[model samples]
Target: MKVYEALAAAFVEEGTTDVFGMMGDANMFWMNALAQRGVRQYEVRHEGSGLGMADGWARAAGRPGVVTTTSGPGVSQLATSMLVASRARTPLVAFCGETAWGDQTAAQYLDQGRFAAAIECGFVHLSRGDLAEEVVQKAFYLARTESRPIMLSAPMDIQQHEYEDNGPYVPSTQLIDRPRLLPDPSRIERARDIVAASKHVVIIAGRGARGSDAGEQILRLQKRTGAMLATTLQAKNWLYGDTDYHVGISGLFGSRVAMELLQEADCVIAVGASLNSYTTEHGYLFPEAKYIQIDTAPNLVMGNGAVADCYIQADANTGLAELTASLERESVTIEGFHTQEVRRRLTAPLIDPSEFRSQPDLLDPREAIVVLDAELPPELDLVLGSGHQTDFGTMLFQRSREITSNYGMFGAIGQAPLITIGSIVASGRPAFVVEGDASFLMHLSEFETAVRYGIPILVVVMNDQALGAEYHKSRAKGLDVDLAVIPTPELGRVAQSLGGDGATVRTTDELRAALAEYVRQPRPTVIDVRITRDVLSVPYRRLWFGEDV
Candidate 1:
């Protein structure tokens, strides 16, 4: 058996059915072998997106994703996407092809191991043959340990070289030390005291707080304690569909009623959330609340100095569960906490009031999402970019549907759509990627991959022709706003050129009709909705306007 065979075998035993990568002359041998051996190989157009697809899939499926790339440029292209995955704290294992050992110094011999190290990624060298199993096992170990992306580079010779299987292989699941909550007694007492004291308490969740075995217990605590629940953008689905308390996202892109609850909170239990600068709205959103922060990582407590009266060094789920148990035993009536009134106040139904009040000719981005939300099948998967579009859509969409966005590390545009593309490929489902003008243009080329893969991805491009968030800021400051504008390529035309079904929708009626037609067709569709520039409003603008400094 060759080292590549062993590597692929390890993946099979580990339960990885799909592998994403771009096949180059350097990696063709191993890639083809893996494909024949039952691992479905996806040959993507760009190496960066290949990495992104795997990362997004990992995020959705709760497992480490596998990506392979050829040497030099192929590996180099993975650097940014890998960093994104790393920053988001996703678990992934990447296999990279390298030049033959003798050609290490050739101009094409860029050190991928060095590249991985630069990002503080766990790196192993399969540059040496016969030790492939050890390196492969270690790569999986590192990936699972910190839930970080690990890159392993195999030299061409090492992959091609044959090896003897000395012993029967056994897959190991060595239990590494899992992150635990410290349960500092005093801090728990303080948190316990805060909850005991406050009449109106809020438990705000972020991405870090989700998916622990303890999450449901925390939700149970919320129910037992009668606390209002809200989540950050990254943690949108953290509270699930219990809309009685789940009031959607908070801060810059938050709901007005959600912000009001946080502002008036007598005690804000910031669980698994960092309480970052945005989360606090630079200190205005929750000025009066005695903040209690809990997370797996203590270093991420953002309101560390001034506001956090109680910092519990425990995983949010564990800590919340412990606190809930204590509270229940003590007969605490953290009860009668319902947000039905808040939802009533916050819900702005978009149904046009008048039959004769002519709708705008250019599509309204908000209305487009409203229609898309109504039209989309309940089971359809959705991936949205981070901006006004996602902010609005997240609030507007049904809570039952699954929504993924780059909310943890929101910037670095053009990446989210690729993430969507990868997710659709990995899940093999009808997925949609919704993006603003700027975000859509960032990786417009990857839509070609959707067409090639026939992923049946319907891309809703909200073509407002500007950096809408900045433009909104410019308008708020009373500055010349057009300076925030951007020149965008005609997305529909580009989609058509790449062999996709494309349509330009101007009116709400046109959009409704286009989306209906788009989804029914047996091809990838890019529906470019020409949106009114004025329709883009920064989240919380409706609530935060005209406050004197």
Candidate 2:
């Protein structure tokens, strides 16, 4: 068997059924083997988008996701998004192909490892023989253990080189223990003290609070202390449907009541949330409230503006249990008169209208999302990739089910559609990707992959033909904004060529009809809504700078 063949099989053993990438000659052999092994390869339009898609998949799935790109420009293309995945600590292994060792004198040769290392990624070179299996094992280990990005560079010779075939190479099953929950008892007492003393207390859950058994503990603590609960967008659904005290989401696009409650609270306990600049309004999100921070990672405490009265480096669940026992010792009621009222405000339906007027040339993605949400079947799962549309979907697409996203520091655009495609296939549920036109174009070819896989996915492209968010910033920076504007083929035509339905809607009625028809078809489809270039829906810049919109 060839090294490429073994790598492909190893990836399959690692629970990867799909890989995202752009094909190039350097890695053509492995790509072919990956296809033959029944591991579907999603061909993206850009290398950056391929890495972005992998990062999104890992973040949503809570496992390592994979992507590949070939030598020279192909490998370089992945730099931006790979850095994003690395910083966000999304587990991803980008199998980048490098120029043949003999071609060291070639002009196309670039130091891919140097770049990846600078970004804090685990960079490995499979530039030698007899190290393929070890490299693969280390790659997976670094990816899962570090909870960070890892890049494996396979030179052309190594990729195609023949290796002695063993009967079956079963990978080692040993993995490091998952992050544990260890609570500090003294800190727990402090939390109990605050809960017992305050007439009104609020619990704000952040991304750090996710996936740990601690979520249930928080719920119990809420019930015990009569504390109202709110979650950051990243932590949405950490608490299941409609508990009496669950406040939906808080921040720039959050409900007025959510903002007001944070304002009114005397004691604010932040769990796992970094309470970064935007979430804190650069210090105004909770100006008057005393802070209590609980996280497993101590470094996060100092970074997210937590001048904690009590900081606990404990498992959120154990921490909560300790706090609960302490509260019981202090005779604090786990239930409250206002807890139900807080839940009522949180569960209240959002009635915010699209802020921008939709002109004939441009459409507001929020309005487009509203129309699509109304038209699509109510039961579908919605996962948005990061971009301008993520901001739009956070506000507009209100579904009862959980909305998952990769809000990691990577902030890569053009990866959402492919991620949705994989997620829909994996989850066996219809999925929707709310993406911007520029981001849509970034991985537009993946529509064909979605079509080939026979998965039903609805990709709503907020097609303004511009990098709406970045262009605005570029214009403000006095850069030539025109360079950011991309004139591309009509997205509908591209969709049609891929054997999928495509519709470009200029109005709400057309959008509704198109979405309804696409839903009925039960196939991959793209709904490109022409939004105005001047239309700004979420006031992203205003929110970023903590400006009153």
lDDT of each: 0.74, 0.73
List candidate 2 segments past 4 Å from native: 1-6, 32-38, 159-173, 237-240, 302-306, 334-349, 352-367, 385-389, 406-408, 464-467, 470-490, 531-549
Per-residue lDDT tens digits of candidate 2, residues 367-430? 7677776777757777666666566677656545656665545676766676676566556678
Predicted model with the maximum lDDT:
1
Model 2 backbone overlap count: 8
Clashing residue pairs for model 2: 84-410, 214-317, 224-334, 362-531, 362-532, 363-530, 363-531, 363-532
Instruction: State each candidate's clash count.
Output: 2, 8
- Model 1: per-residue Cα lDDT at residue 430: 77
Would you list the clashing residue pairs of candidate 1? 181-314, 225-334
lDDT at 314, model 2: 79
